[model samples]
Target: MNSVQEGRVALVTGAGSGIGAAVARKLAAQGAQVVRADITATDGGVVVDVADPRQVDELVAGLGRLDVVVHAAGVDDPRAKQRIADALEAGRPPEVTASLDAEAWRRVMSVNLDGTFHVLRAAVRAMVPRRAGTIVVVGSSSAFDAPAGYPHYAASKAGVHALAQAVAKEVIPFGVRINVVAPGPTDTGMAARTPAVLRQAFAGLPYATPEQIADVAVFLAGEESANVAGAVVLANGGRFTV
Candidate 1:
């Protein structure tokens, strides 16, 4: 409940559930004028599909001005952990490319990679004019150490991290900072889709809750990390070091 972000206009994408929802709530609780954006409407946010450039543009326009942008919208297509396990059991490689359907790959890419880009582009377009803003991209540990059977998701998140670094450099002179927060296997709907056996196998390792990731995002958006830029902070409970 810090008042540091009070009166700032913050926009969070994919805010209907999971990490996105948590980030949105965290920002709002800190007194920021939060504009929760997602494709599906919820009690605290508006519906917005970040993959759609036009929608992103319209959202920024509706906000008039934005000081913080948090991109968290993502999708896991054909979420069937059993199918993944079955494929592996049948000697098929445990890789997304080994068995991921064409539509599934496309869906994941569109939502996670393209969606992040669209939101970032829109945020930059608006923030550059103001010459002051911050952006926090919600990446995943998979970007650094991808597990088997989820190449699409991993690759897309890797793109997100790269984009954040590039944008951080490009916008630094504009008084805007951009960074990423990569969370490990988090306890969210996305993680719940994994097979029970696989989940159990990874149970010993620490899994972060959505709130912990959200707190990191808040730090990135606030002024405390003023000198930080082009950085990817890992909130994975020691799962990956970078």
Candidate 2:
């Protein structure tokens, strides 16, 4: 790919591993100065929990000059996953809303939804002053497709997608483009830990590599996608026809 992002400054959250790490690597390769942020910092990355608004604000403010931002930090509650697994084992559907664990739900939302807001808000504020920026938020197909027994994950991602769309409209006038990439099942450490029954939902389908998803994110962040805004680019391998 071309170094279309030459000389730009980019920030990618959740850069410790998985898709976030891939995105950070790709952005750097495209000639951008990439700042990697995560709860657990690595590779000279800044340590910050996106769920904390103050930390996110500090991270972006310290960047000095921001042009591209990719919000990929998120979590699927392990407690909820355990509940779903136990349900499946009992030959029953996963726990419904009534029986869902409140703490688990809040944990997922804090990171996946609230965290996204903090990062995106900080990035946009920094970019609005310059009137030139692009943000790519990593969402999930579960937002639209609704995975069984994972309300917290689904709700958080759905909120993320909506947040991107709403913010995209608000910032376009200031030359900032915010978009979402809703990927389906991907080959990542997070996916590897999912219960077997849940994984089988995409049995016949091939899992997407982190690099593949990163490619889409990079495209959205570059000049090639200049006209695209408030769009959710689905990279779900044809799992959902709609």
Best by lDDT: 2
Q: What does the lDDT read for residue 117 in candidate 1? A: 88
Q: Candidate 1 on 90-165: residue-level lDDT in tens?
A: 7775545665778888888898999988888999998988899999999988898876777888889999899889
User: Could you tell me every candidate's TM-score relative to the true structure?
Assistant: 0.93, 0.96
Off by over 4 Å in 1: 78-80, 87-96
Q: What tens-digit string does per-residue lDDT give for candidate 2 at 60-175?
A: 88889999999889888766677787888789887767777778788899999999999888998899999999999999998998868777799899999999899999999999
Question: How far off is residue 217 in model 1, in Å?
Answer: 0.7
Candidate 2, superposed: residue stretches over 4 Å from native: none
Q: In TM-score terms, which candidate is top?
A: 2
